[model samples]
Target: MTNRLTKTLLALAVAFAMPAVSFAQDTCSNRGDLDEQYCDDNHDLTADTPTDPKKLKTPNTLVFTFTPVEDPAVYDKIFKPFTDYLSQCTAKKVVFFQVQSNAAEIEAMRSGRLHVGGFSPGPTNFAVNIAGAVPFAVIGDANGYQGYTLNVIVRKDSAIQTMEDLKGKKVAHTAPSSNSGHMAPVALFPALGVTPDKDYKVLFSGKHDQSILGVNSGDYDAAAVASDVFDRMVERGVISADNFRVIWSSEKFPTQDFAYAHDLEPNFRDKMLQCFYDYRFTDELKKAFAGADRFYPINYKKDFEMVRFVARSAGESFNRAAYDKQNAGKK
Candidate 1:
């Protein structure tokens, strides 16, 4: 089978693995949108650790994954140094698990095959609610967490000079769960007089690189993508900035979040967090991640409020049903 078909089939398989769940917790009065397996007795919008010692896990081997926005192999190499540090710091065998899609990453964590991961802004909500992810840090410099923007790009020769000009044109969105590629457009595009699905049909390219390449090859008239990904593409000479015109840009949004599964043994979890916060990135690593030198601390409920708001505005809840719908129709 072609790679595209394989990817679609894999996504569908993972989607089916996400069983139906009810968020109601008899113990917590306000569990918010968390899955039934989790509780938020403290009112924090995150999963609470299992109170029972038998339910907590302290594995000899720790599995790590990064958001599958780009090539997982590329990230596997990029994160090797940190994984080595993690192994030594935590005194365990650390392995990098290269997941092919956001759904697969979330499922790996949910099944305990993954111990910790870096989830993209849009999928972080899904990870938290459905996979018991507890976001604690994001890549940033000393100032704070780094941020990226949503950019709508079209070929310079294309007639689409404004967002309104995109009507009736083929547009590319990375994935339905992507913040810049999909959700942001659904929430913000109508204001610019170009509505997705109504004004034009969205083409799912699966990844930002695919969307960028699609627009460059004339497969798409325009694409909504993350600025950081666009910048990296330009830096890597995969595409030229002068060849593309950015018609619209949104306010800065926080970059991907690094979170751990909430069911880890408390002492092990604390040591792992410290290991992440203490390490400094190499120069190459910093350059690869837009100058982010360290994993700066953050609170998910506060740092991700804007992302959650955008999801809500688009009539989305990061629950199992949403995940299933997002993956079931993958193109």
Candidate 2:
């Protein structure tokens, strides 16, 4: 039985269906910002099928990944229960492929090595534009969705009392493609009387845990990170919430997205999404997720619009050139 959210989503998909065959002759022309390998004939703001039948795929073994925030090994363990359920549901081997970065995860899906995965909020647009990923769900239970806020943290004893105090101090951002960690700061900070690159040179900490840990250890004067990751670290005793002071925090943004490679066979795609929606989080998984349960429905063009707005405001696009530029500075 389709749940209310799934039913509504299916209806929306049908309503958005276009005469895709008519547009195939142009070989993905007028795809807007999407990569040339895809077409958006439906104007649904996502990739459509390849005109060639041979381009569609339904692999016997499905690959899955989660966005790299903390230790990949930790998430590998955290997601094990879900993978086991997915394998049984699909009657195929499901394997969790550990990804070291957002770029690598998107590339894996683009190259057909990854079947489904979670993408961080900032890079979700990049995955849609450049990697042909179709986002469908996020971690949530009965409450509808999961969200996080951008938290600017400094040591509790630090003299920084306001955003202005960040000037001339070392400030860390998680990665170039992070919503709370980087892009939101670039977009929201200037209005608050602190400019990132001008007020202080941005330091890339590679991950949220690193940024928080850097602040805790005094490696940085302050750092911007997602509140959820910070809470998880505190719960796990990696850091204490009391040890830091939040100088600034932004409104909640949607957490990471779960998306599938766009070229999947229609039936396979439906079944894959159903499998995720039907599964409930285990007790430990719920606690780890801060109480989010099942994978809840979402529309990429709607749910991620704010993230795209922030990216655009920062003069950023998810194109290959932009992706390469960000990763080029990686240590």
Candidate 3:
């Protein structure tokens, strides 16, 4: 049933969606200081220069959202305090937008409809490349970030127990754009004597958390997921950490990233990124974040090296082409 549903969704996402390309610049005509290339300068390591810099106009209403990794409705409440704070900083009517799919989120940023939001670690590359999104900060501890690993897990008593044992078994991965959830395993599992979609059928469980739960419930033989999602599930009391055991874990990967539209007014970029660094986690923010207390500064060029490497190995070029290709199946 799980595999069938996943294939159905993949087929749907592929059929109706081709790929998203930045067709034109979302520039404003009446601006004096803004250049035609304002939408995207070469500062971002992702895309080519924008044709029109005038597209960098600030909206009267600053729209924001979180990474759509887990439940979307839950984060609307989780980010409310930050939304309230952003309104004060940008002097706009701030709203927490609960976007459904990664495609929609990219579209929002491209059309100047979305100002700032968070994209999960792997997908951040696409947002930067395809949607012209500028990544800023990430959730971190006192020294830096809350990094994660791609963990291969199975039930304690399951007959198949290791990455080597996963041959011909059912395994659940998250979205195609997911790193720890999909790309890591696809890149590494072959060395372990198993290959995804070849040795075992590849299934998209829609989310990392769902994949974890499916293993516990016997819906899948194993799952490849981000360590952070696994930890949060245990922290939320959805499942016991001990009930499951890790068979394999990849090298350290970067944490989730907070990004804004590339066309954001230059004057506001500093303030917005600063807002992410300055705002202390509110009581409710702390709860939504699963025990993480602060947002910290991270130089994307330096911090995202491992993430970029993993993405590249999966034939993901961190360009508009790869970004569009990955989301072509999502509705």
lDDT of 3 at 126: 68
TM-score of 2: 0.90
Q: Rate the local accuracy (lDDT) of all candidates.
A: 0.90, 0.89, 0.76
TM-score of 3: 0.82
Model 3 deviation from the true structure expressed as Cα RMSD, one decimal place: 12.4
Give the TM-score comparing model 1 with the true structure, all chains together: 0.90
| Separate clash counts for every candidate | 0, 0, 12
Task: Compute each candidate's TM-score over C-alphas.
Answer: 0.90, 0.90, 0.82
lDDT of 1 at 130: 91
Candidate 2 lDDT by residue in tens digits, 254-301: 998899999898888899899999999998788778999889999998
What value does the lDDT take at residue 184 in candidate 3? 78
| Clashing residue pairs in candidate 1 (N, C-alpha, C atoms within 3 angstroms) | none
